[model samples]
Target: MRNLRQKQASLVHRPIAWHVTHWSHDVYSQGAYSTLLPGGSPAHRAALGDCLDGRLVIAGEACNPKAPAMVHGAWDDGIRAANLAVRAGARRVIVIGAGCAGLGAARHLSAQGIDCVVLEARERIGGRTHSLQLGPVTVDVGAAWLQQFGDNAVAREAERLGVRLVGTDFSQPLAAASDGPVDGIEAAWEALRRGIDRRLPLTEGVARYLAGLAPAEARATRYAIEGNLIIEACLPLAELSVDSLDEEGVGNDDHFLPGGYRQVIDHLAAGLDIRLGQPVARIDWQGSDVRVNDALGDFCICTVPLGVLKTLQFVPELPQPQRDALAHLGMGRLEKVVLQFDRRWWPRSPTGYLRWYDTPASWVEWLDLTDAVGTPTVAGLIAADAVERQFSGRSDEEIALAARDALQAWACAVEAVR
Candidate 1:
């Protein structure tokens, strides 16, 4: 990794002094899930089981079979685990992390008149949901959008927090297939939608059938299906399980939060007693009680991210079944690069660019930010795999140059349409 960083630094044209240093250089490590099950290969489970003792209940988006790595799913899991712990007669329950799940757990407990403590690993709350000051406005560097329209918990939270929903217009002129002129972009979109629609039912049916099988059988089938879907959807289908889709129903009513999605976390964390910048080093749950040790001291949570649990060292290892389940789970990598332009350089459009490159580094989507804010900022080249790799060591200049080149190509394609 150090060699990679040095190589990245050497590749850039500008002086090393001009390059911005990433404090947390692990781009894949987005701290997105504080209380989610860690999904990976069998090896991931072996590492994860090292942290679990029987009493330390694991709950988070990752832990959820349906919504393994989404913010809302994690939140829901935390709440359910907290409720379970309370019902199990736990007197004082602590939330191990302060992401959406942790906050959700704490909020539910508080609502139920149960006192809980939230321990966060960062200085501020919200694990992966965060915003940054960009000149005059705040830009969301973490979670920027909500999926599934108004039905999802994040969307509902956005509404409750009074965050305005704005539509993304990707109607910009761009290069299209040999089908026709620039106007054919609409046709391309329609075709893509139709394609997705046709395959979606098949995928869903397969998922449902696989969901009922024995643990081993289900894991094998679901893993294959999910791997394919990740490539097709550019998202982990496990995070958008059949349950979530059924709950939302079918719709073209997706929405984005104006103040950034992080505001939802802020609203959720209000008035809650949270401890930040405390990373749990160990968890002891062999005894009747559960104990979590960070740099500060020992605390307790009804549940923790299964991934985190799997990594932490436990005095006594977890049982084989739970360990096996953890091993079967997997984590998909999704990365985003938000570029704030000095001016709105890209053409206007109702639909964003859905590029199809012959190479692995091809960006899947390019979102326009003109409607979201008056500024010229544009979030472009949102690629899952490549971005993760680039984040490892690429300098800001290298990223900027690459984005500029892509934008120039897109701009030319749009001009050809005009």
Candidate 2:
């Protein structure tokens, strides 16, 4: 028994909170990989295999079959596309979208003495992986954490570039509230794994699957278990597919970049012919020549996001299978609220993450930034449809108040439990 009654009087040590709204089209929508809908990775395969008349090449995390939706996947795919372009006897290549994939391809092409240009829609280098300066410390607003540092491409790159990584404790929840700890969380987790092992081709969503097991009798306990799953999937429990969840697979030694993910972008974008604020509307490709917007190239590599690609038109419209694949793939919405405080108020726990069961699914996980940056700042992540449904219409102040209230309730609950 620990002394939980030693909670601070005020829930928040600081009144400043930064609400960053990441739209589906601009930053990201379909995070990492698509939900294993009816026809899962087949669509991804079709898109990757079907390159417009051999003149246009598709490269991005989505095109990667083994590791889709990962930064390293996108990087590797760019190199793969670059190799394809070179094999096709292309002297010059124009890479669309200066994201990780696009920048990666350009870097490889440039190294091979192949002329290439990177066109980005935004004025910045990183697309979704943006590092924002919050108060005295700088934190990554998007794509902050990296799983399995050992043998991981992104991790290797970070290490080679001299970026620091802080390990995270995912074994236990840092804090739980209002429901007196909901003691059966671990058992519920084990039940989920058992259910997964038993019913393999689980076409159903996680919500119904877990409900059948009746892992945790308490509603709060169930929420805590599901909340963690929801954050990982970045989708609502009902919308998430069990097959996709199983296929994604987990990594070991999860770590966060205390120096931010922007370092990776900077390292990848060194000395490349990058053109910013270039929103390509159309791509016209014939036998040996391809035109991106207005630029001409022997071959073109398209690396724009699925959300952005959905809006753009290809001259010889993509094949039926490719169109179907794009239609079936969905974008995962995420909302982050980062707060900086003057003093550290939360207890120092080995588990770096916190979850509140009573709160709506929208505001579920909070990552403590105190250890990483030596500042009393915390980031609250809200994923799935919850971002648009719960926090879209609300103002920053309202969202901040709701979050503060939730934290207060959790703190008060901990005190009561002790």
Candidate 2, superposed: residue stretches over 4 Å from native: 1-13, 25-35, 42-50, 183-187, 193-221, 247-251
Per-residue lDDT of model 2, residues 351-396, tens digit only: 6677666545556777888889988877877777667766657777
Q: State the displacement of the C-alpha of residue 192, model 2, in Å, after optimal TM-score superposition.
A: 2.9
Give the distance in Å from residue 357's predicted Cα in candidate 1 to where it truly belongs.
3.5
The number of clashing residue pairs in each candidate reads 23, 4
TM-score of each: 0.69, 0.87
Quote the positional error of residue 412 for candidate 1 in Å: 2.4
- Compared with the true structure, the alpha-carbon lDDT of candidate 2 equals 0.69
Per-residue C-alpha lDDT of model 1 across residues 1-418, encoded as one tens digit per residue: 3543343344322221111223233332333332212233323322332323323556666655444455666677777676666666555666788877788878887887776777776788876667776655566765566654544676777777678887543333233311123233334333323333333444455545555556644443333232223332333443433322222111235566657766688788899989887777566665666666532212245344444555666556656766766555533344445566556655666554333222334344456665676665655443335455555566787765665555545554444446
| Residue ranges of candidate 1 with Cα displaced over 4 Å | 1-55, 168-252, 294-309, 352-358, 381-385, 388-393
Best of the candidates, lDDT: 2
The lDDT of each candidate is 0.52, 0.69
